[model samples]
Target: MAENGTGVVEFVLMGFQLQAAQGMGLFIVFLACYVITLGGNLGMILLIQSNPRLHTPMYFFLGHLSFLDSCYSSVIVPQLLETLGTHKMIITFERCATQFFFFTLYASTECFLLAVMAYDRYMAVCNPLLYTMAMTPRMCLGLVATAYAGAMVNSVVRTGCTFSFSFCKSNHIDFFFCDLPSLLKLACSETSLREQVIFLLAFLVITTSTSVILVSYLFIIRAILKIRTASGKAKTFSTCASHMTAVALFFGTLVFIYLKGNMGKSLWEDKIVSVFYTVVIPMLNPIIYSMRNKEVKEALKKVLRRMKVS
Candidate 1:
């Protein structure tokens, strides 16, 4: 409790609330996932840096995406593992706020970066002559930096707004992590302003990024349609298949969690969806890219051969 009896000093996270046997089973499962997420993301980063063939605008954005996914998982999974182990976990007010900030920052940055990647693909496929000139190393870096900067501003504002509200209702958060919807439900003060601000920021980030991706793909699809040969169309579309998959998986979850009208109505269902995006998505991204991308697969084969020789 806070000194001003109206506020909560800490929150009790009622995690999945599984039985002892189920909790231990989930702990092992989540631990395995965390390990794979780290290995896959970090491995993707190393592969990109080491392979000269991957020294292109697309791979450059991908390296950052892998880094973001790694950090995103790190922000939420460790605490979730603890919660699964104990069936409940306690987080201080400041700690919970910190988690929310970084989580928002990484997630928002990823949303923007995916859009940037879609544009990168558009330049390559829809405007091949200008691709090299348009997406230079310097330009790519500037776009990535802009994404990070925008995410930072959104995170700072959302975190400030969310924490500024009084949590006098109860200190029990229904979700595993310090998610915005879950925390907002515990706010005792009038949360209309905070909710509005959070919603507007979220709407802008998701909508703006989604719009960019949709437009980029439309242009890309037009270009593909103009190709005379089936092989040419397949090759051009293949370049973007992995990115399309990633965007759908990432944005689909965001739409369901943040944009839905029936939030806080189904806590159990929310937990499952949250786990899919936070825990499983990170582990799947590298796999998706590696499996769908021939260049990445070839690069992995070369690296493996070198390891065997050494």
Candidate 2:
């Protein structure tokens, strides 16, 4: 194993302090969640790809969101499962860093991507006639590309700064995975500067993306209100319902954990919130979108009918 600054080659991940029965129960539950997350996300991607009717800017972004959720959950959930099953898990510094890097990358990208999706909704709802012109295939690709590029830069900096601290003390991380706040507790060096830097970057990302979502939704709501009939307003609002629900669930937990007042103080609360966002949300996204979306439902029905005939 490669020595990371302080000759600490590996770190022990303390999954959760629980009795045998509790651990076993959690293991089963989390395993089920992981399976569903993978299946649902992958199915969403395939369904979108298979249906030409779903080939719009909205579904294009949704397809990528499903992909990111799959990868984001995969990065942390497997290690989390191992830790929960074994009670403790050992990870080399290099491997831990790798996991952290990818986790951050996928997560940050999703934040920006969600905002992009919101903007797509705004255009579709508020400027239906111009949506096709505004959200062209090339423009959609560019937006997704920009999200990935920005996230990559953030991930590189966070990984470098976080792992740079010398870990001269205990190598045991109290949390299941290699997260920033949990890992920071083990640092022997001064973390104030790096903490500020990390926080600033996180703040910029969360706030900027949040601004976009809020502003887009503001316009969306206004446009919905101006519709001639209640049915018209409801129909237009329904299209944004799924995306709004997703944004609330995702950004709610994110804001609570990362951007709140008592950050890192409530480790237990943090862990619970972390589990929700990391484990449960991925499994829920495909369900939320497919169930609320008429187009996706119709496409799924068509697929099922074709399968039966064969």
Best by TM-score: 1
Best by lDDT: 1
lDDT of 1 by residue, 1-310 (tens): 4426547888988888788899899999999999999999999999999999999999999999999999999999999998887665889998999999999999999999999999999999988999999999999999999999999999999999999999987888877889988888888798898789999999999999999999999999999999999999999999999999999999999899999954647778888999999999999999999999999999999999999999
Clashing pairs in 2: none
TM-score versus the correct structure, for each prediction: 0.97, 0.96
Evaluated against the true structure, the overall lDDT of model 2 is 0.92
TM-score of 2: 0.96
Root mean square deviation (Cα) for candidate 2 = 1.6
